[model samples]
Target: MILPIVAYGAQILRAEAKDITPDYPDLKELLESMWETMYYSQGVGIAAPQVNKPIRIFLVDTAQVFERMDDEEKEEYDDDPGIKRVFINAHVQSLDGDEWAYNEGCLSIPKIREDVLRPEEITLSYVDENFEPHTETFSGLTARVIQHEYDHIDGKLFIDYLKPLRRKLLKAKLDDISKGKVSVDYKMTFPK
Candidate 1:
């Protein structure tokens, strides 16, 4: 089932997520629902926080995009783009390189976008659907998306990385969002 995604100003998005346990009932079903929700929302990634579930779990699938591209196109893409990795109780083992900034957005935050600085690559570990432990290295856009979603589980938002000037300009908008003064428009281009 495709669950309704929690929008900006939802308290769950601000609260840190709890770790998932192996014995949790319906774990498999929950992951399926998450994938459905993400696909229905036309998102490349979806975190538990975005679904109002404060749990350390998220999904990413960019396979379709890469699979359709030719060899030259794939070669032009320096990073791995074919894997759909799911993370449960995941943690970043290390970060590499100097701070790099990218325009970041979130499914929870809707249309808002901000320049957030993060590592160019990250090493992370997590459990798969079968409760099997796994670890992988990620870089480029994949790393950026992972870091952004990972932060959500820690009660962090991309706007938290905004500079003083940017924050000031967005203060009213954010305030309005938090107070329910504004509405969520589905057409808004998010993760800007």
Candidate 2:
């Protein structure tokens, strides 16, 4: 099933998510639904909170980004092959390298994109969908995708990184999104 993504102003989107146990009910089913919803929304990453579940779970798939890149762009990220994986009960072990800017957008905040600055590499420890633990380091666009999803679980949004003046300028558009006035191809559940 493709769960309805919670919109930007939903309280759940601003709350820090909790970790889930291995015995969490219907774990496999939930992951399947999340994956379906993410692809349906044309998003490279989706956190549990985006689907209105306050749990420390998220998915990242950067293969499409790399696949769509031109030959020159591919060579630029020669070391980053991209990844498609689930991250559960994740914690950032370290954020290394310099900060870089990327135009980022969210599934919940449709039609709004901003240049967000984040670290170039991140080392994370997380469990797979099966609850097996693993620690991995990601860089380049892969790292950016992970960082974005990771922020959702931490109760942070890309817009939060914007300057105060810029945020003020976008208040109207943000309000429109909160009130379900924005147009998007995917399904969303707006705040009450």
Candidate 3:
């Protein structure tokens, strides 16, 4: 099922998500729905908050990004191979390396993209869909995607990183999104 993404100004998007236990109701089903929603929305990542669920869970699939890259660029990401994974109760243990700017967007904040600077690498600890614990490091575009989704679970948005003036410039557009005034291909639950 494709869940209606919670749009900007939804209180759920601003609230910190809670961790879910292994026995959480319909865990597998929810993950499946989230993946369907993400793919349907053409998003590389999606967090629980985006779907009006205040849980520390997010999904990432970089295959589409990989598919768009040329041979030379693909070589740098050979190890990733665009694997999809579920992250539950994730925490970024550390962020290292120089910060780089990337154009970032969110399914919740549809049609809005901005250059956001983030660390080049991240060390993250989280439980997988099956509740297995793992700690790993990620770099490049993968890391950037993870960081973006991670912010969602933490009640942060990419636009929050922008300069005050830049954000001010986008106020009207953001307001339009909140009020369901913007056009989006995917279904969204806008704030009242």
Candidate whose TM-score is highest: 2
Among all candidates shown, the one with the greatest lDDT: 2
Q: Give the TM-score comparing model 1 with the true structure, all chains together.
A: 0.84
lDDT of 2: 0.93
Cα TM-score per model: 0.84, 0.98, 0.96
Per-model lDDT: 0.77, 0.93, 0.92
lDDT of 2 by residue, 58-160 (tens): 9999988888888889887634568899999999999998998999999999999999999989999999988899999999999999999999999999999
Residues forming the 10-long window of minimal summed lDDT in candidate 1: 183-192
Question: What's the C-alpha lDDT at position 140 in model 3?
Answer: 82
Rank by lDDT, highest first: 2, 3, 1
lDDT, residue 123, model 2: 96
The alpha-carbon deviation from the true structure for residue 42 of candidate 1, after best TM-score superposition, in angstroms, is 1.4
List the pairs of residues colliding in candidate 1.
105-191
Q: Rank candidates by TM-score, best first.
A: 2, 3, 1
